[model samples]
Target: MMASNPAILPGDVAREIIAPESYAAWDPLLDTFDHLRDTMPVAKVVAEDDVFEPFWLITRYDDVMRISKDNKTFLNNPKPVVFATREATEFARAATGSNMLVDSLVVFDAPIHPKYRKLTQDWFMPRNLKLIEGEIRALADKLVQAMIDAGPDVDFVKHVAAPMPLHVIMQILGIPEEDEPRMLMLTQQMFGGQDADLSGSGMENMTPEQVLELVSGAVKNFEEYFAGIAAERRANPTDDVASVIANATVDGEPLPDRDMAGYYIIMAAAGHDTTSATMSGAMLALARDPEQFARVQADRSLLPGLVEEAIRWTTAVQHFMRTAAQDVEIGGQQIKKGDWLMLNYVAANHDPAQFEQARSFDASRSPNRHMAFGAGAHQCLGLHLARLQIRILFEALLDRIDSVELAGDPVRSSSTFVGGLKTLPLRFASQ
Candidate 1:
């Protein structure tokens, strides 16, 4: 049988890196990806199971940067930012008559993508976020107080990290405070499908097909909810992100239902989780290395670097998929047309050639243009908002938290995508 196609090529290493269980097995993946970055650089993932596609796993700093920046050749349209499980892909195709990928800015390529992004582009600009700084700061302060009230030993994820970003993003979207819980639940189900603890679907006995149904159900709920919001906003306009989506028009036409809802969902899901993960990682880093915490506490100027470092270190939004439109060569490997490739941000961020001490957490590393927020055209739209939130929160945190240390072994969400610690138990010397 043609020698069984030689198992395609990059072997068990690639498989381990993307494996869902490996999400909790953090250090092993770091080590494996580090080896691949150093050795293979741009390696084709040898596909063993039929769950994932056989494609290039660009591990090096240069290769990832190139692919991420060159959005045209490696298009995000059709199949964007993730290699879906075969079942999910088929489900989406059958249900929506499209790929399982959601069509947001991250999922769209040029031309149409730019126009769609332009709708709320100004709203997310630094100037706009600055206008709402006071509101966000007040929200952050309230969350800090809530954390303080929770007392000596608290699950940081449950008390602070999770709620803080959810509140901020919800406020931005003009979502009622009461609806925050619903938003959180839907987001968890969407991105946390791999982690039963976070998915809340009791997925242990469920097969992949069952989990996909759970995920599909969640997406349907989001779509229905956003549709109602879109109608309400159009009828009675408001100043929040929801209103913007409702009134948003592309080339003189109202945005398609899916894109509008996808935009809202992306902001809701991505807005909180990435920020929460980074915050969790930052707190974890500070607890581990008190010296760094003290230094940041002393000089607040280090807040920006701390945020950047945390994003790179955590890499919450792990990988994005791209489809090669034509034959292309990257890192000396020929990428055939229509092949799906994963831009492994985790590996790229830790490439030793790009970062001097890529493994160690360093807040002083200047010129740190890590691909944590991604790069080029599709770089995170909420990057400025995420940065501002982290910067300000740390400023508030360092000022209030007299001391922070881990109270127990932290637990990470078991997911290949959007994974982070679900529970970061910590003992803090409250201010």
Candidate 2:
């Protein structure tokens, strides 16, 4: 028999594990995850200050994979799918009458989750997305050309990383090119609410209520903006993702306004940031390792590994919280019914047992079972698009990018979840 709570993390370690600032520094965060994996791979995160509810923190590769595959036992519903502070959860309850702020695909359980996810699932598959290959390549080339123009020295994030996926996803959504910046800003505020750099809200010294208010306001804007699109699409339906969503039905009725809005927000907001993060991460990894960059540059076939390793290296989605439906055993530890669990992708992806020299950013790492795009039934729907976007972007880059290296310190976003590099300074020379 295993213990009910295997081991509780020390107060300082526990707080740092959830702290937004701690995530900003990559080394310390990795150190914390490493320590957890070594000591209590399946430990309880008991916070005395109660910043968030107590949950089981799953740090090992095997445990996270098992929980992800057994979705029936580990539920996304009845809990916040993504991590939420106790204050934020209570705030959401009072405001939206739900435990979550948005009931998107990320929050739903099976039966309902499958039905909603199936709506746009085909739109993201490789067979369907292949039709847009030319468009993706063109966009990728354009961004790379922009990068070339910005060099011999430039900020890759601005010149290339941010815009490629933004344009691609926006194109699929039928958003006009000019409004992409506005879309980017809203998405940043929504996901990066806690990070002052990402939110642009100067969120210094803000309380939980204030953060909720700010995020709520952003969601409102997204809803209002998409509401008009939803109405227009219903009136004049076209062959776009938004049109599919606008006219989509479940149980013989149109999706409710809130659900419909959630669909739009996921497509418009959640689509690009992760890809952008991976793109920046790819550049960062290559910029730091010239030999690896040269290898990929010369071979060209290693582009897939480059793309995948970047996703794994970045592990941009961070962690998603799950609620245990019944008492279960995992990693020589015990769990109980109704217990919350944090499935940390960062720790799982970087686990040395799963990946050789996991922290070294090996662009050639094969069989890379990274959970950056998640796994099982709830795996990221837009993964093909992400891969295509990254592959094409790097294809264009490798063609012209003679060299790239760090110019100044790269800064990561100060956020507990859904974040990556805020600014990456690079010095590059194009042939």
Candidate 3:
């Protein structure tokens, strides 16, 4: 076993690396990643109290991209795909008889993954997306008008960023308009448990037990909610994604109850949250730099660059854990069979080796081939939809808003995963 000392991230640094609060403060966390890439990019993160077993942290862009593309060697199954503290894993075992409380596409490996993904794969493709463009534009128009009517001082997260993706996803899922709030609330509890504002638990410093309890409840809510939706869709089939999952089959059999629920949860949660994060991050960048904002406003052709850059800048869905299926070497370190590894997207996205002036937000950055949507088959399924939503919303914003700037301090979500700005206050002038 590797000794837990100065070699890898120190005990304190390892703990902070996984902590929610540390993620809230972006720069300090980047400094830690910068240090890791320079000294030990593939070092083990050892726990002092043994609350969790050690896992290698992959910091470099090349290493992360390699693991992401090669799903066979670095598989998602046989380990918790997301980082979980020892206490949380143990609690999950007791509660659900599994290391993870929820299982979804994010946790599945090949054969099974390919089959399940094929169910709704075509629905999210660019050709299908064109059919919904009018609806999206209409939503954008209504939302942008609402923002204009909302006065000069507006919380961008509340008024614009959060709702655009949420509504788009909900419409695609065949969920009723009235149920949108419930869906958003449930998602917040699931992904935002560490944030006091998002979790609604009324406690900021929650215990491991409390966090697990809240997460479990949210999962239960999502499962119960989607079960009914699944049943409805199966009975009265529609062209929506929920119908596809409800009627999907693998090996000539319907998906098991748990797998079906997992499908719905991933579709419902990851479907909207990550896009919202990128949208908010993009707005934050424009609000801070008026020149780029004016540039994009003058030349509408820069919209695609703006969207791509924001996706890279935020890199929501930060890290996904992959267990080594066999002995392999990466970044000058020998990794053994069955060892767990973290593909740190945030670190890779910011690596100077990959991105020039990695800190500066470039709306017109070229060759931006970022791993923000991940790589290979496991890449984010909603990527095209995310890009479309951001583009359409910004088009609407450019049409209505003459100028914009930050009204106050913007705050970020306290989560190491599925994170971006949660509170972005902006002052805008109507065109």
- Which candidate leads the pack in lDDT? 3
Residue range 1-431, candidate 3, lDDT tens digits: 43334256788889888898888898999999998999888888998888887999999999999999998899998888989988888877887777788888888899899988888889999999999999999999998889888879999999988998999999999999999999999999999998999988874677778888999999999999999999999999998998999998899999999999999899888999999999999999999999999999999999999999999999888899999999888887888899999898999999999999887899889889898999988998889999999999999998888889999999998998889999999999997
Local distance difference test scores for all models: 0.84, 0.89, 0.90
Candidate with better lDDT, 2 vs 3: 3
Ordered list by lDDT, greatest first: 3, 2, 1
How far does residue 110 in candidate 1 sit from its true spot (Å)?
A: 1.9
Give the C-alpha lDDT of model 1: 0.84
Winner of 1 and 3 under TM-score: 3
Query: Any residue pairs clashing in model 3, and if so which?
Result: 51-86
Query: Per-residue lDDT of 362-427 in model 2, one digit per residue for the tens?
Result: 877989989888889989999999999999889989998899999999988887788789889999
Runs off by more than 4 Å, candidate 2:
none
Q: Which 10 successive residues of model 2 have the least lDDT summed? A: 1-10
Q: Comparing 1 and 3 by lDDT, which wins? A: 3
The digit string of per-residue lDDT tens for model 1 on 334-354 reads 777898888888888888888
